[model samples]
Target: MHEWALAEGVIKTIKEYSKDKKIEKVVVKIGELQQIDIDIFKFALDELKKENSMNKLSIILEIEPAVLKCRVCGKTWSFSENLKELDDFIAESIHFVPEVFHAFIKCPNCGSPDIDILKGRGVWIEKIKFKGE
Candidate 1:
């Protein structure tokens, strides 16, 4: 749902910013933390572009992984679990505010819960090709 919002926002932003410009290509950078559906987004992008006079538009998706650092040991690594495993962990932790499960979490290395999210949290419209009449 959040991914859909971001995707929709991207298209809206593109439309508003480009005005009369027609889009030919769209490149999106999705971070691992965002948990976005690339295929669904591709479908949404196609649907969005079809609503306009842009005729045919193509979209490309790029992936970026999130990195977490242990505040105690200074150990940093990419988030290694798939969505299902992450979901299970989240569900078992709090089940209410599962998002906060990462807060003040101790490092598995040094038993320090001071973990910092280092990367991969947002979506970016990396590049776009516009055909202007």
Candidate 2:
């Protein structure tokens, strides 16, 4: 799964930032639009940690919900609030290309296609706790 690659990148980044220090905890914020499978991501991270002899490291994942602003009505709402409006085909399309949601999904407030995603577009490391030396 691609989660393995993502996990690897995270591990690499942590290693670089830690610079030989042991990691006690890692907090990751995953955007809702990214559609990351938590189970697979955790599995990949666990495997990577084991490989790197960091099995004791704690990984925490936080979900950042997608927020969209309607350009027409100037209203903002969570994407999940309008999930029922998305058809299977459109949902699948958005799952692959999150940017497409603005074009295909209309604003719930004014039914306008002009919408701007305010948040939840990318993955990031929120915080890292290093082990005491």
Candidate 3:
């Protein structure tokens, strides 16, 4: 899964940021739009930690819901609210090309195809709790 690559990047970033310090905990915020497999991501992190002898490191993952704004009506709403309206094929298509979601999905208020995602677009490291020397 691509989550492995993402986990690897996270690990690398943490190693760089922590330097000689020991890492105690890491909190990651994952956007819902990313559709990451949490199990795979966790497994990758665990494996990396084991390989690096960082058994004490604790990993926390949080999922952020996507928020979308309508360009025509200025209406904002959670993407989860309208998920049921999407057909299976359209959903699959959007999963491949998220930028084209507006082409298939319309604003709930004005029925306009013009839309913009206000939040929950990518993954990020939220917090890092480290042990002081």
| Backbone N/Cα/C clashes per model | 4, 0, 0
Better of 1 and 3 by lDDT: 3
Q: Listing every candidate in turn, what is its Cα RMSD in Å to the true structure after a full C-alpha superposition?
A: 4.1, 2.3, 2.4
- Can you give the lDDT of residue 22 in candidate 1? 65
lDDT of each: 0.66, 0.83, 0.82
Q: Candidate 2's residue-wise lDDT over 36-116, tens digit each?
A: 788999999999989988888898999999898988889999888766677888877776667877777777778999888
Candidate 1 lDDT tens digits, 1-133: 4445666788787778777766777787776765566787777767666775444666678887867788778988666542345555553442333245475244667877677778765578888888752
List candidate 1 segments past 4 Å from native.
81-85, 89-101, 104-106, 131-133
- lDDT for residue 94 in candidate 3, whole number 0-100: 60
TM-scores for all predictions: 0.70, 0.81, 0.81
- Cα lDDT for residue 114, candidate 3: 90
Which portions of model 2 show Cα errors greater than 4 Å?
A: none
